[model samples]
Target chain A: MRAAVCIALAVVAVAACACRIPEDPDGTLDRVEGGVMRVGITESDPWVELEGGVPTGGVEVRLVRRFARDLGARIEWVDGSEEELVDALKEGSLDLVIGGLTSKSRWKKDAAFTRPYVETTTVVGVPAGSSLPDDLDGVTVAAELGTEAEALVDAKTDADVRPVRDLGRAHGEPAAAHDYVLDDLGLAAGTELKEDKHVMAARLGENAFLVRLERFLLGRSEEIERMLRKEGRP
Target chain B: MTDRRETEGPFRRFELPEELLPEQRKAVRLEWLTLVYMLSAVVLLALTLGQSQAMKAAWIEDLLSLLPPAAFLIASAMRTRDPSAKFPWGFHRSVSVAYVFAALALLVMGAYVFFDSAFKLVTAERPPIGVIQLFGEEIWLGWVMIGALVYSGLPAVFLGRAKLKLADELHDKVLYADAQMNKADWMTVSAAIVGILGIGVGLWWADAVAAIFISLDILHDGWKNMRASVHDLMDARPRRHDAREFHPIVDRIEDELRKLDWIEDGAVRLREEGHVFTGEVLVVPREDDHLVDRLEELAHHLLSLEWKVYDIVVVPVREIDIPSRDGRPRSSAVGEEPARSP
Candidate 1:
């Protein structure tokens, strides 16, 4: 009986050691049990979306889901546009804004961005036989306002820019109004949105947390990329 | 019969001029050296990983995460190049460049660990040591530290041995130097294991101190080699003063040729072609009646120096002034006797 008691005590000790709260002196995990992680995500096609009234598919969505799992927390996804995602993150309603966010100095005040997982240069696509335009000028170009693509267009050309609400519309929209659509890595020279690389953002003070989380995520990124490749872009 | 042969018979001779096969053989050895270095590192690392207080075997594994993939990339890149119009020299140096890249990766890895540990040590932040039960014995990480030594040491020995052979045969300086670096790394890994064990025995600063020393050593070696490989790629020449040994042989050849009564003056210049030396000698012969036969014979004789000279070109100068001695025609002494190799 005494031996049994000692074994029981040792087992208990190991169990207790396992459960002791992680001394995250870095405060990497923003919330303990009750702390809700308000994750602001864009409802962009292919990369993120809401399915059956629950958080669903997209590259960033899946990436963040795995991150949440590692942090031992539940994610409450808040739907919003990229601009609204930035605002939600800034207003403190969201703990992290996940989507195709790129690192820009202008967003320094609103949200902190993680190290770039993928870097890409802009590419222009045209109808199979159509020649690619030399520049965006004298052409109808589509781009989301305040995006790197739009900034590139503004800096590189004198074209009459058309603002599009979504990436799909920007590419799927008729090219008669403009020669091309500029957005992130993909340019719709004809009528298709090309694939590009983007980033995820969170509030500034969460820098340490995001940095560590990014590193952890990057280590397991092959799996995340494999999942993305399996599920074609939305 | 022996005297007759010695006076007017042929000398038995064989010279293994490096061909495609021997070069390919050296390449294979280089690949093997790279593999041995990597495997030994993994094994030694596996041994010492458990000794550290914070980073368990798994953590060390994670830290070592990038080495294999980067090494694979370099190995693959070397196999991708084919002979092209733009690159007629072939991509032999690509192999050297790839090796330099591997060294750079190792250096970067060392730096990353050193900086991270130094910051932690300075802040007095003691990392949590995770204890695991192995083979029914409660083993502290001290054993893992010793394992690291074995992991780094064994492969180093293999690489050093192979590299010495490869260097002597192929005359590849980079591979030979890298072998020395690997030997040094074995010592570093051994030191790191000792430091980690010291930490396990309650000397907290031991592990970090060891890491700092190892990092500095790896950084210095890596930086020096990377710079050299880059210099070679830029087609830099050896300093003029440094060419003294070979310079004497070329000078003596020209001096002997000038003594020839039938020759006016001989100008010689030397250049390296791969692992051999080829000299272009300009001779102003007295007449052109037997010019072709004489120059060709002279070229053949110079190339007969199997160990030192590989190829020779003899250019006959038609019109050039000669310093007269008693109004006698000067013939090249070089055509009469061979120049000694330095």
Candidate 2:
């Protein structure tokens, strides 16, 4: 009984500890202020890329800009290679990383991925005259290097897969002239291709941030779909 | 000190036994001191009000000045009175009523200062000059007010401390309530200090605004104290074990009493009327004659605790073995009766 009373008191004390006021009287910021928001963007097409040394707009860029304004912070865009983006996040050089990145098993060890904003599908686009390999047995499928789509091809088939600099290049006319272009773009790309789907990809630990960005894009998805259709047209 | 035959006068006919310890006498003496201090402050404030000439000052003074005298007069009267025909519980409620009246007056004074100052702040085209002076020099009236507050506040702090001690010793609701009122005086004094500082800073409306804030605080405190006093007076069940020190002792007693399987469905209620613990155990007795003796021994064990345990009453309830419709004997049961006062 003494033990029980002591245990009860201990439980109360633990509960009291949780609710103890922080020594610093000032409260935690529900709204952010007073810092440069370092946003890491992979140099992927349409979503993010440097055009003439000026970082141009994309679905992710517009989404983050609004968040920056609300937070009273300046947006410092840090463009990097896909691997460097993850490296920058790990090194604490970047607060966030955004691109057409999917939360796949391969990236799980490196970075945290936010919830999917959009779903994409895997599709193969061959030239009008060229015979396409259905099984991808001996044929090479062109995919963006270090992408989830490339990983899927590596996982699913023993096909000869060639890596492209970007998915945009893979889905372009020149790359399409080669074997088959596995269009590993977002669901918008799939709807545009009408023959395939693309899985949207994001870095890790950004589920809420990605969800918010995706919702914002989803609100203006029609315009984005039109742009993707125009950009990726073979 | 007076003869018993002269009891018809405005004095007590009965005397308490000389057996009361020195500490108990000290408690009574302090209670009297609390009354006297409150009354004197009231008289001083009242005279100050009468002596002032300005319309606003005099009016505010008249309102603010009534609290201490009223509280003292009524609480003292209640303390001295005998149990009457109409009120079987005597006029103990007079303390609460007196506190209520005093609190109400303080609230009014606070509000008056708040509103009057706020009005001047908003509407006055020109800042009013500090006109009132008490001595030969042009004494800063605000400073004088602050000084008066300090004079009232310091004494009240001591009085309140003494009253709280008295309340603890005698289990007195009135003195404790007065102690609460005294706590409010500290806030009032603080407000006066700020008000004076604000005046010197050329924010002529500061004093009044501070008073208003102070008033609201007093009102809240007054309402709470009154509510508590009323609740206590209405024979509110004594809190069992809110104190930290006595909780372990109480828990032991409760656990021990509960161990007897035959003593089914009971609670041990403990209360502190003064510094003494008064406990009642509602119990179901077993068939064995030794059960009562054992319970008495347990009660004695509780009384022998280092903490103050004045009395213990073990209320034994006979276990009625009521048979079910199918003629099966029921389990042991207990019910409450007013446990005999220890």
Candidate 3:
């Protein structure tokens, strides 16, 4: 048994020694570092936004531009729906996709995600003079339609949840939105609801590129948070 | 070997002077050693329990591997106890009881791993493997996981080799079964490696695919052992240790019964109670003169046929209900007579 354990340990040592660092199968990191980077973008508020029919603004949009320059690569942006961009990313046509994708993104299984670069939270906030209630049970709370906060509010509280197209304009009324937007809408925070871990998508199996991108994004967490503070201003 | 006319049964018993006592001690020592090895393996496997389906399976298999040694050791300790008023048959059959429970665990755990991996495959759940830092270097977690599996799995190969040798010497089914399990460990390690490496190579489904195959293999082993042990519990004729074929001792004892000059024909039935056999023989007698003396001698003779024979009863009967060589219709098998020897 001792001899067998030793043999196995030796094999592990050899395997570990063979590659101290993990290598990407398609060499995405090497190719992108000194070449043009193809980026897929979609309109997601605060992370991505489209102005004049071109992808622009948002924290992730600006971060990707900086990431491209850091890699010494030129940037090219492609705009499409989440499904279309994800399919193209899977096909290796686009190196990265940014749409304020969260851990709860529907395309999670189909794409490789970088480590979460930033974490955002949803909270039920009320205008300053409103008395703070212990909980939202049976209390009407406005949550944005088609957002994770909407589902989180329903799951985490017995609130008389009302879905609206916009939570920003629901000032003075108790509502669930990104915590950063609470102060902008003149609402004081109350109940902390749920958190979202935001990440970027890469083609599956691009390990080195994913790690490099993760490192790049994770390094600027403070900057991402700072940029997020300016978002959704009236 | 001399057939000693000794009293030994549910009502009475005595220890046969074991010439292999030292060897038995060695076998117990070996079992304990194997147990320790598996305990360490279980720990190592637990540490590598990442999101990969294959690693999870390999961990479960190693965890299940600890059962055989435990059963064997407990049964050995119980085998030495004296019969009590509450349990006159003694603890000789404790191993058989343990076998059933061990088989049950194997079946349940194996099935769990199998279905979970298959579900992951069908649902297209990508394994969430990422990077970890080792000595200030960011190495992929897959390499560490695979390496841990190899380290955890390798010692079993050599342990299996050692157990194989001990099995031959001790003629122990438990040791042999454990050895067989160890031999298959390499296949599991290789399959898991393939799965982990597949993830590295861009085959997203490779980990799940490999997991399904590994789980199927484990489930097969579990099913086979479960069937065998359950049959043993039902007293389905004493088969060879592997439960593949009938033990030759049955035929030898029956032939010996027929060889007795006063017996016109004879039939024997035996049941395995762990390491030993207890049985009855029915004979058609041609003569009754000095029959009582002859009966004791024959019973003694049967016990000496093999070390596994713990006790035997020789009875004079009008006739033996010889089971037909051809398949008896199911209706007849359940007809008028309810109990018939297979």
Candidate 4:
């Protein structure tokens, strides 16, 4: 019995030594080429929008789909709030994140951003016929949670900023840009609040993925512009 | 008058032969590498703290682990210094002192981490891990933890393997102890990674469980090192290479002395001072004439038995004097008389 146990132990030791993972120096590129590229998205109109519980159309969706094809890989989409998506990107679960993300995202330190693909102005939206509040101090303004618009309102205005999960339920009025379609929500866009550039983010130190993404974006500028024009929004 | 004569007695200081130049050079190089790796581990661990409670524990272990290598480096450097009025035995025993100190540090760290982890397990306190937004996704904190473990573990394995061979060649207990600590580092780090990954997957108890296992392993090593070092400090009979029992060097020496034609019977006592032996023996000679010369020849022969037997004093005994009723002469009486060929 003891001899059998000794032989078993020897076999186990040999097996343990034999089975070791070879180091992949260029892990990001290897993952992108042979594994699923996880993309995180937030609900933003004209950039990433859901139609009947499926991502129907968006400039970001098309661009990412093309990039995945170029890498000979499949894409897995994860949807969450801006903070959740950014957190996923930083922790390396998601290779890329897209949702009309502004270049001024607070998570810049944690992840690298692609060059801006589009630029637009931030504006305050008031309920139709209500008129914009002047010298707005102590006014309660709602912005989509975890978005740059929320950060902008908090930093650039004395107004009491309320973060709403969905802007449609923002009741009376909220702040957003033209693409968000405040007019369709029975609200009117006020004076431009801030000029902002939109970009995608990737995990920090994933230089290969970032380089490929930047190259893809640079090559598809004309297509992106055309898509923007077709959507009838900046 | 007797104290003055003893002070001026023929106490011919013995010196072990210097190690081959190449081996000495290799040892120095190994120590430098160990010091550099230890410093880097400390810096990396400090930078990677605050990720989780497991991470904090790892950082503390790394901090405590630095003591052994640091002690080895200092002791090895000073081990060859000449004896002075302040230090009568030169600096050879520094290695043994370092071994004891390093063992103590390990024991303390092991006990502390073990209890702390057990407490955390009982409390079921979930570790709060923060996530960073990359590209547009929320990645869990597990990947960061794995990366930190890989960074710390790889260098430690390399350094540990490199030092172990050199420690053996040099017969350095302190270096050997330090090397063991470095070797076990990867196990702790890998366990921490698994724990963090488990917690990431919502297994809340895994981190503490892994920590407890790691601490137990460390405690086992610490206890072994402590026992060995304490035995050396007390001048206990040296153990064999495996350290399971007493070494056969003393027994072999006694046998050789008894086989000699001029000697009736002999007693051999050996004690380790760091990596070397310094002890005395009482030989009952068949005749008193030319007894010192015979013993000198025997002492030289015994020294050749093991290079570690650097000092041995052989006395010509008239009879088996059991003064203390233990059949063993007082070490103090035998210790004063240096081996001199008359």
Best model per TM-score: 3
Best-to-worst ranking by lDDT: 3, 4, 1, 2
Residue-by-residue lDDT tens digits, candidate 3, B1-342: 123345564333333336766767877887898789888878876776656889888888888889988988998888757779898667778978887777788789888888898887797666656665578565677778887888777778887888777766655666677777887888788778878877765565878888878888788888888887787788777877655578888889877965777887777778887777776787666777888778778888788778777767777666566552233422231224334322
**lDDT per residue, candidate 4, A112-150, as tens digits?**
677676776667776777744563567778888898788
My TM-score estimates for the predictions, one after another, are: 0.41, 0.39, 0.71, 0.54
Candidate 4 has a DockQ of 0.03
Model 1 per-residue lDDT at B173: 49
- In terms of lDDT, model 3 sits at 0.77
- lDDT per residue for candidate 2 within B55-77, as digits (tens), equals 23323433443454455455555
Structure candidate 3, residue pairs in collision? none
* Runs in model 1 lying further than 4 Å from the true structure: A1-234, B1-37, B43-84, B99-128, B234-342
User: lDDT of model 3 at residue B10?
Assistant: 33
Q: What is the lDDT of residue B33 in candidate 3?
A: 85
Q: Cα deviation in Å at residue A207, candidate 4?
A: 27
What digit string (tens of lDDT, one per residue) describes model 3 on residues A1-234? 455465456445645665523456667788899898899999988888898647668888889888999999988889998999999998789999999898788888778887788898888877778775566777898988887788888888778789999776787788887777888888887788888899899877677788778767755778788899886553
lDDT of 1 by residue, B9-38 (tens): 242121224363475466455656566556
1 or 3, greater by DockQ = 3
**Candidate 3 TM-score over all chains jointly:** 0.71
DockQ of 2: 0.00
State which candidate, 1 or 2, has the greater TM-score: 1
Worst 10 residues of 4 chain B by lDDT: B1-10
Models sorted by TM-score, best on top? 3, 4, 1, 2
Identify the candidate with maximal lDDT: 3
By TM-score, how accurate is candidate 2?
A: 0.39
